[model samples]
Target: MSARLATGALVNALVRRAGSAGGFATVLAKGDATAGAVLIVAQDRGENPRLLERGIGPTGDVELIAVGPDGDAQAIADYWSRRRRNDPDLWVVELDIAQAERFAAETMLGD
Candidate 1:
């Protein structure tokens, strides 16, 4: 499947997972080359610092996940690992919900 389709599927799955826990997840693809913060939320001082050390900064209602040719599943795993440490109470996944929705639609249509 195309990367976009795969990403969409991943997102859709994550959204469902988030929904089960009363949280929400969304996907935002950058049409331009502009890079900026994706999420900004308060974290305790004892929280996991890997994200900060990796330049992730913080987590907000929206968190940024990298998607592209250079992006791989390992990147997603690393992101989640850091996120879990930073917020043990929250659940984070690497799938892209928007992409996942599209994937689901296509799959339903048997495309």
Candidate 2:
């Protein structure tokens, strides 16, 4: 099996990439640095909010899965808050960009 990137490193890289691309990215909650799971809150300039997480698809390949509410910012925030409460090891990052979902998926699954 291939090795995985540390959660902290990935988070930093993602933030840098988003900023470099003229977008906004920030960590909502910090989790374990070594092996925490990441949850991405993607939005297009603070609109069309979506929650993305890496998960195994039916074909067994890891892919970005859309979880929680869509379009509504408040519902998405509540959803992530609830999830974070349950999984304290989850890293929550918010990305507001042109193609937030694509950026999140590439940065998260590329490594």
Candidate 3:
């Protein structure tokens, strides 16, 4: 199996990449550095928000899966709050930018 990057490192890289691309990225909740799962809350300048997480796609390759509420901040917050309660080791990140989904997919799958 191919090696995976540490969760902390991946988060750092993603934050930097997003900032460099004129976007805003921040870690909402930090998780285990080595093996935690990551959840991305992506938006276009704070609009059209989507919550994404890496999961096995139909072809068995890793892909970003939409797993939470979109377009409503309160709903998204509630969803993630419930998720964090269940999985304390899940990392939550929010990225606001144009094409936020693309940025998230690239940062996550590229590794």
Candidate 4:
């Protein structure tokens, strides 16, 4: 069987990695420790903010899929707000990285 990492560890790893890379990272919403889903919002200085959610592909591999090119703050906030209402255990992380998808690809747990 494959081992999975906990949510809290992933959150901390993300924060530390972003900081070490000279970027900013913060957890907007805390979630369940064991099985919460992670959503990442990547924003750059004058570009559209992109949102990615953790997903499992057909082959059982984890990947980041773009939710939207949401440069609008209110729109992204509103979207997550609606999502938060449904899943109180969902984690939302904001990372100020240009290539934010790499974070998910590198951080996601695997065999």
TM-score for each model: 0.27, 0.95, 0.96, 0.87
How high is the lDDT of residue 43 in model 4? Answer: 81
Task: Output the lDDT of residue 69, model 3.
Answer: 80
lDDT of 1 by residue, 17-93 (tens): 65564444443231112222222121123232111111232453222333222234455456655654664433332
The collision pairs in model 4 are none
CA deviation > 4 Å runs, candidate 4: 58-60, 109-111
The root-mean-square deviation over C-alpha atoms between each candidate and the true structure, in angstroms, is 14.5, 0.9, 0.9, 1.9
Measured with C-alpha atoms, the lDDT of residue 77 in candidate 3 is 89
Give lDDT tens digits, candidate 2, residues 38-109.
999999978888899888988999998988899888998899899989999999999999988788888889
The CA lDDT at 51 in model 3 is 91
lDDT for 95 in candidate 1 is: 29
TM-score of 2: 0.95
Best by TM-score: 3
**Model 3 worst lDDT window (10 residues):** 102-111
Which clashing pairs does model 1 show? 8-99, 8-100, 9-100, 11-96, 11-97, 40-60, 41-59
Flag the better candidate by lDDT, 1 or 4.
Answer: 4
Mark the regions of model 3 whose C-alpha exceeds 4 Å error after superposition. none
lDDT (0-100) at residue 88 of candidate 4? 92
